[model samples]
Each structure stands twice: as structure tokens, then as C-alpha cells.
Target: MGKGILIHLQDVNESKKSSKLDIWLDEERENLLCDITSLVKIESVAQEEDPTSDEPFGSECKKALDQFLYISRRDKMESYNHDGYCASAIIGSSNKTKPEIGIWNHLDVVPVGSGWTYPPLKCTIKDGYVIGRGVQDNKGPAMAVHYAMKYCLQQDLIKNIRVRQILGCQEESGMRDVKHYLENEKAPNYSFVADCGFPVCCGEKGHYNVTFKSRNYFSRFKELSAGTAANMIPDEATAVLVTEQGEKTYQCRGIGGHAAFPPGSKNAIGMLAAKLKKVIGRDKNYLDLLEFLYRTASDGYGRKLGIACEDELSGKLTCNAGILKLEQGKTILSLDIRYPITVSGASIKKQLYSEADKSGFDIIKEEDDPPYYMNEKSPFVQTLMSAWKEETGQNDEPFVMGGGTYARKIPNAIGFGPGQDRDFSVLGLSEGHGNCHSADEAESVDNIQKAVKIYVNALVKLDQWVGKGMVNNENI
Candidate 1:
């Protein structure tokens, strides 16, 4: 764990704080915790999709949506669930009008894997932190934005500008909730998903998800179970092999984290695949496929597949073999890749398909989420950066990231704070505890308290900016 940048910024910024919102936040801290706790208790992990049902993702997601709307109504905002695919809590207008700013937060979290000194499904407010599965990844941040909207509305700060707070049900799976909403509704002029690091995100790497299967049957391996989700680095991978001699089982363990940020995470699947390849891999139909995948993307860098590239903005391309399965002699491997902002998704896919075809693999499923980028110097981006600077007194410039957020799916939008940069000293950082997808995910209460203030201020300024039609014309 590293010393957080927020700690330094807070040390300097708190001394100068004198806003009425800040004072109100201090008074309402306990209430805020209650609301956040209520949310964390819902096991809103995505389940089998039922398109015909109102709760398309699952009952838990629907329950999560209902809870969010309930909280919104409690906060005196107009709230509605859009057939359980997504929902909204809006302020500033009762009349039908397009929103100027949209705040996106997801209720669904990745499946809790292991390692917990605290509970994974419910909130555990300990020391100065609120710990749970979705605490930092999204739920806690979502509530911070929710409270900010509440503060703005009660203070009569939201005037001509209408803001829509969006709660997504399938962010963990594929963000189908937001996709369905945008397909049936109009998006806000400017939106920010508080799902990334503080300051601001000006660009996001292109998201390329692909799945390839073995061309021939590999009957030796009966079962291969690994990874919790497509976007999470696998912590434990197990392989069961049926050989003439006997049955053999192989298990590999490694540190886990969100696949997009693979620095701290160690890939267990890659480890297992490498070990098996060295020991028994020979034919392209069997263990050799794992060897090929591990060799191509083991390090999370796309250097071997000819997709190794970087830009001045969004850094290097990252490739994680996050999902793998073997059923009925077919070997399936799925990759979650974040490519450079400047590169063409088409070109990358072309090269990738060629490589797989030559290696005797069948490209089964492939999807391209094109890269989104805005000028760092753009007035819209600077305005967001200014809000962060005012709140934290930190001068970290607006950045581009590999992590995909609703900002990429929404037009002319960027990602703002609520993302913890690193572990603050006061949180008493411990090992085996992680943030976002990792187990025992945590969010400091102080972090939430300050985020509300930051978001409240940002919302006010963003409303003004959007009202002016200061759109990023170049990107749009």
C-alpha cells in the first residue's frame, strides 16, 4: 500500500475550508453512513439475464434499484426505476427536459472471491473506514454523489440546470443498463462517472474484449475454472486433468485486482498455464493453447501480439486473460484488453484475428468499445479539474486511463473523482484488503465526506458549464 495523495491534499485543504456545505456535511455524516450501509447490504451481483422480466439482470439488481430510488425519494428528489434496467433520481425540474449533467453510478458489483477481515456483503464501519464488497468500487462513491445532489437541492443550488443521477444495474457485466437507457432516452449534455481517480479523466483507452476457442478437441483437461469476472484479474485458477496414469489437479494462486489496473495484481491463470505448458504442453489442441495465451498476455502488456503501443495520452495497451473455461473438449479463453486512445480499434482487431487464425483458434465472440478522448486543455476538462483542485488543493493534472467508465459510453463526458488515489495513512492500510474488485473493498468515511463536498461544488460549476453549451466539439 502507498501513502495516498488525498492525505497530503486534505492536510493542506482542510485548513482553508469554510463552506456552508462543509459544515452541513459534518452534521449529516451519520445519516450519510446509514444510507451507504443500507446500499452495501444488497448482494446486487449480476445474475442470469431474463429479457422478458422487469428485473432483467436479476431480482437483486431490481432490489438494488428500488433501494436507490427509495433513497432518492427520501432525499426529496424525483425518482423512478426504468423497468429495472436502470433508474434515475432527478432534481431541478418536474417538466420534461433534457438533463444538463448526468451522474452515473452502478449498483452491481463483481462477485466477492475471498480474503476478508470484514464482511463482503454488508457494510462494516470500522476505525475510519466503511468496508464491504462494493464500498469503493461503486456503492460508496454513488452515495456520495447522491448526497451531493441532496445537498444541492436542499440548498436551492440547482436552479435552471436539471441534473439526473443514474443508477446502473449491470455495470459489472457489460453496462447493458446504461446502454438500454441511452437507447430509449436522451443523454445529458455533459456527464461524469465518479468511478476513477480524483482530478479528472480526459480520455479512456479503447476496450476490446475477445474470446477464442481451440480449433480441435483437447480431451485431457476435463475442467478449467478460473476468475470471478471478465474485468477482474484471477486470484486462483484450478485445472483438472484426466490422464491414463490417474487424475491430476493443478491449482495456482496469485494476488488479485481490477483487470484494467494490473500493476498490483498477479495473474493466477497465467501462472498455472505457464507451469502446465512447461510440464506437459505439446499439441496446439491441448495445454499448448494455454501456453499461447499466457505467452501473449501473461504480463498484461500487448507486446507479443503486435498490439504493443502507446500514446501521449492514455499510455500503453494492457491485455489480461481474465476468463477461461473448458467444456466438452473445447478450450475457451477470453481477454479484456485496454488499448491506446490514438490507435484504431479496427486495426488492432485485424491483427489480433490474424494471429489467432494462424494459431489454429476460432474467434467466437469479439466486441469493440471504441476509445473516448477529450483535449486535456479543453475548457470542459479544465472546469472539472478546477473543481478537483479547489476541493483538494492538489495539482495532479487531468489524466487518461485504461479503466472504462460510463464517461466512455456517454457523449462529451469525462470521469471525475470519488476514486481513491492510494491508501491514506489514517485508514490503517492492511494487506489482503483491497479496493474495487478485490475482497474487503473499502472506502474511508472521511473520503466519502470530502467527496460529497467536492461533488457538490463540481455539480454547481458543471451545471454552469453545460448551460453555456461549451461542448468539446472536436471529440463529438
Candidate 2:
């Protein structure tokens, strides 16, 4: 099978010793931990952008980044900002032609979505886990990358390498802030977002935020509102039906999960609205939309519409009727769809509307994020995998993921470590007995160490890979 391009853990250890990475990392671990704790202590919530003020998520996020970069400023490092939406700090000798490597991370975190056993803002360390909201999702990795970059620059880890660390503020809701920077500024050469799991991520499915609204559908529907964000499915859906039986409250509740995996969900928004419509005398549009979505979304049909594209790595398309709202005579429903890489947004909309026309429901399109894919054998994937093997001794293969990250926003970018493989346990990654994005999110000390080492080592390999003409910059 092409000689199996996998490196063992022993080679990683020997290389670490030869490079003196372990010794240098050991000397800086305590300082790094302190910085990580401080960063996590600042609570950066995703709120509406204010044109007048500089601090949108409050000054905590901006303050944390400012303090972190203060060290760089003392060393006379290069830095820049974009409307307080984000900040990027860089350190290295002047070399523009060299492959500019970047470590991407977000500083602002999702608002504490209720259900927290401990305070979501404060960093709590108990049972060897730092319990907090941003501890795992991006804060931990952000801190780790910042410190790793700091150490690399101070120690001159890799000769003739340029590294930049970009911390994003509005990553939870949208990346318009980062988009503005890219349009107004320049893009990185080769980059890795340390926000997803390892062995590595080579692909991200297309994201479609579709809105369906029609004046005729659900004539008896009074009020409708479903989800919080386009990425999360609605756990609880509530609607008031103005039927002949008088106004009735129709409610549907389920455990909300990521929109990328919509099965097993009770579909609070869809079920409640549909059930209310059924009670008030079914509308063809309502019934058709429900049936079409259930059948097409679950893979029983609608393959021609690119709804059934599946791979051995990432699973099939996941659809969620997340948002619902009715005003005057018009009813609106927002659907969060994550289609496979093989699917296009146009094909999906055409198929959904082709069925919608028969039901008399008018479809309106909203946001669209194109699908992203990378070769599993690409240099970026190989270097990340090699670093993971060295850190954890796991020989895992790269794969695609359902959730989207900053990696997809830019070319030649993929998500690398900070999260463990399937077999490894991340006890403190979150407070909800899981890792990332969930409530009570935390980061373990041990996992942080491993993540720092992996990222640093990967950067080292990246330097060599670019020098040897292994990475293809034309894709960027």
C-alpha cells in the first residue's frame, strides 16, 4: 500500500532529543501553563459587533491578547489588528519568500449555553482538569500555540522559518472579521488551525444555511423561533398555533447536538411546527417539506440531489430544521445543512425547491460555505500525523470531519492537533463529560503538553518539508 508512510514513536522521541525540544519545552512548561490559565480566565463572548467601541466581546479577550503580545512588543515583534474582530502577532527574521506558516486560533468563545456544573467563565482546576467554557474549544489551543511560537522564536527552534499566530474574536457566529482581514490584508502560505482533533483533518463538508418562508404555508401558525446558531441544532422548539380549537401551544424538545450530525434528534423546531400544522388541518406545503426533508436528509432518497454522498472517512449529509419564526401571515424556517464534499449548494437547493414547488412553499437562500477537501497523503497531513505519532505513539490516518473550522476559510489550510485521537481520553477538555464547544469545557494539563509538543514539532517538519519542495504552494 505505497510503502505505508507512517513513522513510529521511537523516531519521534529520538528526534526530539536530538533537537533538544524536550529540554527546552520542559524549562518553559510552567510559564506556558501560567499564560494558558490567564488566557482562559478572560471570558470572550460572541456578541453583536459595535462600530463605535473597540471591545466587542468585552475587553477580556482583547486584554488577554494584548497582554500576550506585550511580550512580543518588548522584543519588537510585528503585530496588526482588524476592527477589534481579531489580532495577529508575528516573530522571526525578515524573509518574505520563505513559506509563511501560521497557527490559527479563536479567542472569543460561544456564550455559556446553560447546564454548567461549575462557573463557565472562571478557570476551575479540579481532578486534573481546567474547567471552563473556552478551555478546550479554542482557548487552550490558542494559548498553547502562542506559547509554542514564543518558545520557538526565543530559542530559534527552526532556522530560517517564519511563524505567525492569529487569534480570532468572532469565530463562534461568523468569520466576517477574519474575512475582512484577508480581503484588506494578505493571506498565509501554509497554515494549520489547532482547533480540531488529531490524527488530522483533510476535508470539511459544504455548509448551507437555507431559509424557507411562504405566506400560504401554516396559515394558523402564530409565532415560531427555533435555534441559536446556524451550526447548532435546536433542542427546544415552541410554536403557537391559531387553529379553530383556539390558540394551542405545540412544543418539541430534544438533546441539541452539532448540526453536522442531525440524526437521533427530536427536531424541536420541525416536529413542533409540523405537529401543530397537522392538528390545525395539514397544509400540503408543510407535509411536503417534512417528508422531503426526512427522506432526502436521511439517505432513503434524493441521491441525485447530492444528498446521499458518503465517504469512508466522514459520514453522509446531516440536515437540521433549526430555526422557525412566524410573523404576520408569513412563516419562516431556517435549515442548517452540512452536505458532503461531493455535493454542491446549487444542486441541493435545486432538488429541495423542485420538491418545494409541488408543495407550494417558496425557498429563500441565506449563507453558503463551500466544501473543502485535501489529499490525505499531502505534506500537511503527513507532517501532522508524524507529530501525533511522536507525541502519543498512535499511528492514525487522516480523515474528514463534519464540523467546519477556520481551515476551510483559507486555501492550503487544515486542522491539526490539540485534541486526542479516538482512543485517547481528554478528561478536562470540557465540563459536559466531553470535549470542545460543549458546556463545562475544560483542558487537561497532560493533553496541553502533548498538544504543544505536537504543534511545535509539526512546525519543525513544515520547515523541512517546504525546504525539500514537499508542500505544493500552487494549491494556495
Candidate 3:
């Protein structure tokens, strides 16, 4: 199989003017599969309770970090473990100077929920797909960049440019890994996070998570819980309500999807809340809260709350009632809102507070991250665009996304893709791959291979452009 891959590599090298990146990826396909599979099996789900002095995120996250660093060291690369928050592997110049380009990805995945044709932790390669949690959301893309660096190292393609691949272990949770790395290490002059879709993601909407809680709410509900993560639309929710005759149990079922794109998903939390309201009547304070959610939960544009807004660049604001729980006699609802680039967090918050006050709920906690954007005509974007068009023969323009990535955290950084918009149509899979925080997450091997090619070419082009002094890091 190895020899066959090499033969394909040689054939492509002989036939094409472009670099043999695609062929080299084909050659290393099995190795790529092995690397991602091995990393996936470690179950690197970040747990707040598992933090220690050595492992800030958790022991499982630390284990995943250790495994990644071990692979880097084995590949004869300079690697560092940053107190377990994140890890970095460097190829090219060994100088302590700043790196010219940075490739960022996350290693930690969201908690694997129930329902799957295969175990979520074990990598299952079947019919040209790599199925498992974190395969697409991050781990696979990270490995793709890793192997791209390996290709550059073997070909001695490292000239004046140095590439740093930083892998974080807590992206799905709170992105503290990258946060820790940036504090201890110098930020890359320019970076691209491999955590979005193809073409290029030049704009990302503001991310705000708001929690509504009230202890004074009148409720006959004894216990209720739904959703495992705040960024995912709840698929299943259950409530045990106190009734006049006897205690009653209720459940709501809906399709789960990424909170960023919530239009198609039927939020289970919202559904259950509506069901409870119907049974318990609308006069209760708890029902009022549920009533607000049930009315606006499915509206991605924030219309029912009077905060509906949109702009040409990033489109409309979206909101998802991601989590619902009854604890300590207080009913809590966690909302994940991705607002348009034009809207201010303050504006959104004011409207939300107004609605919450009217509904008799208090805003217990609110966290806001401003939107991130780069002018489409910048040298950085153009460089990546050229590489993408050259490799794919498509001239699609760079666009905005609702999903926030490390791009929002790093200066002049943007989200590039290992997956494309057409991936579903091409591969015959549904949006979010029926995984992405849902059960049985999987990423296509073919998509990973294509992304490897694009990354290699982009790195080569970026190195050349930076070496020629085309990009001014200070201005960028």
C-alpha cells in the first residue's frame, strides 16, 4: 500500500506543473488516518473537575496533548507542551525568532452523546470516510496540517519562512488552551485557523452566551435537563412535573445541529418548555420564561425579541436555546447567540435584558466576544484565495460565517477550510455530517486529502510572499 501511494505520487509529480502535494497526501493517507485515529481514541473531552497543576483542562486533555507532542518529537520536530493548555510543533528554522505563518487547530472534542452506528471514540474507516468525534471539528484538520509540515520538512522546502502548528486542547469548551499559549508565546505574525469551511472564512459573527435564571419562578416541575454543550442545539429534553393527580413525566425530541446554524434544528428545550406551559398554564413565571423561549427559539433572526438584525457581509443574527435545567429551585436557560457583524454586543444585550425583565427572569451570566473580520482585498486574504483557486479551479469569493473560531482570538487571523460547502452534495451526507456534536460524527478522508493539498500550496505561497516583503506584519 505504501509503495502504491508512492507510485501515485511519482506519477502526479511527473504529470503536473503544480507541486506534488496531492500525490504526497495520497502517499501519506494511511499515516494520516492512523494519526487521527490514535488521537481520537484518547477521549480528550475537557472536564472542569479534572483540572490539576500539570493538566489545566483535564487528565484526558493532557493525555491527548502528550500524544500530540510525542508524535511531533518522533517526527524530529521542535515541540513544546504549554502547561497542558496547548501544544506546539515547529518545522523549518530552529531560531527563536517569530514564526512567519501559524496554523491553529483544536484537539479536544465536544462530549460524545448517545446514539451511534459506531463507537464515538474509536476511529472507524469505512467506504472512504473516517468516522468518530473530533474527526472533522478539529483533530483531522490538525493532523492534515501536521503532515503538510512533514512534507515540507522532508522536501527541505523550509527556506526563510518558519511554520508553527499550534494545537489546543480546549477549543470546544472555552478556547483557554490558545488563550494560555498566546500569553506565554509570541503571537504568530499571521495565522489561519483550520476549523471552518472552504473558500475562506474572512468574517465571523460576534458570539454571546446569555443565561437566564430565576429562583422565584412558580413551577410544579421537580426536575428537568437537556443538552450537553451550550454551542449545540438541544436534541432531547425531559421534564418531571408535579401534577394535581400525580407526578408526570414528559420528553421533547428534536433535530440537533450546530448553534451557529439553528434554522433547521428543532430545539428540544424550547419544545419541552412549550409542552410544560400548555399543561401548567401560562400564568406561572416559569411558563412566562418558557413562553418567551418557545416563541423565539426557532427564529434564527432574533425577531420575537425585537433584536432581529442583519447586514450584507455576515448576514442575520442567530440564537439557539442550547441548554435547559432545573436546579436549586431555579429554572435556567442557556442561550447561544451569534449576532451579525454590524450589531454591537451592547445593543443585543439591552434588547435581551428588556425582554428578560418583562418575562420575569434575570440575566445571571453573560459572556460576549466581538465579531472578527478582515477586508476581502487584504494581501493576506488574496494570498490564500490565490492558493485555493489554483488548487481547486474554483474562484469563489471569501465569505462570512456564524461559527466563531481561533480566528476571532488572533489578530489578522481568519478561518480556512478542510471542508467545503459542496461537501454534502458531493459526498451525499447531511449538513454537520450528522455528527458535529451529534452522535456518530465523521469526516471524509477525501476532504482531508484535498485540504492537505490546499494547505501545502498555501504555505508555500505564503512563505514566498512573506519572504519577498509583500506582507507588512506590523500593519496587518
Candidate 4:
């Protein structure tokens, strides 16, 4: 029942430089940049063990929310933190009956991991780019949403609706932050997360995190450690190989990157795991497992290890041996696999365990994300696609991606804007140049403006549904 309305700016040139709400937004750009740069200073990486019973990531993430709330309050808007979890700020017209609209963005970012020209905690502006952690992934988009909403509220341009910007603190590791918010707070009517790429992201492939445990294999080894994060391909993995002789250590080196493009960087744990067979010659079974993994990496047809799957949306299955350790004669392996949309993680795990059983390697599932897909003609896709075209005269269709985002957490969610084709080329974001989660990762100023424009237009187009009362109660 949602309707779409298109509004072309009176002067595409001037409006492109400055929309109807431009003057207010233009005045606030410097302040907006300062707020986003400040948020990037907090390290909100998810951690397993807590220094105390209190959540560390949650508290660190709260600092970001506090900074944002401070900025919003200065902008003359009411803002508050949701139980030290997510943060919300709202602005609307006198139309109290206007349907509620939500612009969701997460403040928590992936670990600043390693290898950076500048300190990950410090935001540096150079060559017209803001370089730091969380610059691209969510912080940049979060700022864009902030500016868009601020402009609407200040100019009183939004009609017949209230818009809210929700900032989640635990989106990188999981949806626990948002989950807690939903349990204690009211849900939005219509929402879109600016957490993925543009022109549009109509489909996101399934994601699964499974820990394959093998026990009674290497009891002599006292300890083993590999990766700190599941989403990042481990750059270093060390194993304390033990036998009747003594414990020998083997260290593997590589670069950590998103699993989507794993070939550019080696999986250190994977390499070390493969070398385990060579280091411990008597363990022929472990050797076979190594051979299976190597063969799968070389060719996609390795069935002896149960680590292969094929699909069209995201192409083939990608497996990263992120964590491995041998203890109490038991080998534990955590494999992060992102499968294509057509395949199920359950089926993939079944095949893997079947092979492992034959080879005497026990395996188990740790996490799984069901496949998500949407047609280009679907309302979500078309609306975002139209926004992209309105901002830029290109008609690029929605596409799928291997990397997971908050879009996977919410039903019917799609990734929109903050990345443009020119920005891709200018910033050298053309696949494997190191942008997101990489050292010196930053966002371009031009892209920031383009993103603000796109988001504002999308919000406007979504207003029709709000006006019609079709989206007010729809849980997005």
C-alpha cells in the first residue's frame, strides 16, 4: 500500500550543489564532519571476555552514542541512549499523525585489527578524505543519515511524518544491541539501513559461522590460538604442535581482510593448518585434512573435506580457516563460510561432517545465516534504484554481495548509498585496493555529499507511504 513520489529539484545544478534544504545542511557540514570524526575515536570492536562483568564493547560504544547525542542536542533535537545500548534522535513537524520513519545505522565497527598508517583511534583528514577506523563501514553512513535528518528537521521540509535515526552499538559482532532495543522500545514504521553499497543492494547472500571441533587428536599440546575475529581472515595463526618428542611452534603469516575477497591475502591459520600435516608426519589423517583444504583452495571440487558449495547470487562458497588450536589431543577448527544464495548452510554442514566422519575429523556448526534475496521489481529495490537514478543519471540495478550487514538482521532490508562509481575509482575502492576495514581506510568528501542527497531523496520518496498510513505499523 506504500506509494512513491518523485520530485526533481528546480535547478539540478544549483540543487545538486544545494537542495531545498541545502542552506541548513551546508551550514552544518563542518559540524557534522567533526561529530563523525569524534565518533571514530572510540573503539567499539566486539570482544569475547570482559575485563569486568560489565560489557566492554557496549560501554565503549556508548561513548559514540554520547558524542552523537551531544551533537544532536546542540542541533536543538532531543536525543538519548537506550539503556546504554542503541541511541535514538527524532524530529518531526506539527503533524503528530504522520507515520513514523526510521533511518537505522550502527555505531559499532569491526576491530581496527592491524596495519594502519595512522593510529586507528585517531581520525586524520588528508587529500580531502577522512581516514580512520569506521570511516567507511558505518560511521560515514551514520553521519550522512544525521545530516539528512538534520536538514529535514531544520528546514521543516519533511511533510506528514516523523523521522528517527537509530544508532546501534553491536551491529558488527551481532544484533544484540538492536535486539535489546527492540525488546524495550517501539519498532519503526518504514526503515532502511545505510550499511551497504550503492546504487542498491537488493540481495544479500547467506552467512554462517560454524566452529568445527575435533577432539582426542592432539592432547599433548598445552595451548593453541589463531584469530581474534570471525569475520576477518586471520593474518596470523600459531599452533603448539606436540608429539612424543616435544612441543614445536609453527607460525604462519598473511594479511587479514574481509572473507569476500580472500585470495588477495593469505589465511595464516589456513596456511598453518595445512603445514600441520607436514610438521607432524606421523599424523597421516591430519595430513589428509590439510591436503583436502589445499586442494579445495586450488580447485573447487574437493569433497573429502566437505568445504565446497556453488551458487549464482554470490558465486561460489568461500571458506576461511580463521581459528585452529590443538589441546587435550583434540583439534578445534573454526571455519567462516559464506555460501551462495541457492545453497543452505545446513546442507553444506551435513556434507562437511559426512566427509569428516569418513576421515575421522569431527565437525560442528557454530553460526548460520539463512539466504536473503529480493527481486529488482520489489518495492525495496525499485525505491532505492530510483533514488540512485535521481541522484545520478545512471540506472544501475540492484546486485548481491558476499559481505553481510545489518540488512541481514532486518527483514526486507537493502543497502543504499554512501558509495558512488566515481568515488570507487577515485578512492581506488575498485575491489582489493583496501577500503573497508583496511589500513588508512577513509571516506571521500564528495561521496559524503552525494550520499546525503541520495538519502534525503529516498526519505522523501518514502514519505508517501507514511502519509497514506500504510507504513506506520509495519514493523521494519
lDDT of 1 by residue, 3-55 (tens): 23212323233344436777888899999988888888899998877876899
Most accurate candidate by TM-score = 3
Model 1 C-alpha lDDT versus the unseen true structure:
0.79
* Tens digit per residue, CA lDDT, model 2, 1-476: 12143342123455655367667767876776666667666777666756447766567667766765664575456877666767888865467666677778888776566456677777777666777777778887887787666666776655555788887777777776677667776788777888888878888888777777764645655766666665665556776768675887767765555566554434565556446545644566556545543443232223533455665656787776656677576666666677778767787777777666665557776788888988887656776777777667777788787777888887678888677632114343321234454556666766777777777767666665555454455532
Off by over 4 Å in 2: 1-43, 47-78, 217-222, 241-250, 262-266, 270-306, 421-435, 464-476
Give lDDT per model, in order: 0.79, 0.66, 0.79, 0.68
| Residue pairs with backbone overlap in model 2 | 224-324, 224-325, 225-324, 428-442, 429-442, 430-441, 430-442, 431-440, 431-441
Count the clashes in each prediction.
0, 9, 0, 6
lDDT of 3 by residue, 302-411 (tens): 78788888899999888888778877877788888999898899999999998888887889998999998898877677777777876788979999999979989987
Report the C-alpha lDDT of model 4 over 169-265, residue by residue, as the tens digit: 7777767777777778776655567877788776676777766666446554566666666666766777676768787887877667776656566
| Runs of candidate 4 exceeding 4 Å displacement | 1-27, 47-57, 93-97, 219-224, 240-249, 292-307, 326-329, 421-433, 464-476
On the 0 to 100 scale, the lDDT of residue 166 in model 4 is 86
- Please give the ranking of all candidate structures by TM-score, highest first, separated by commas: 3, 1, 4, 2
Q: Please state the error at residue 464 of candidate 3 in Å.
A: 1.6
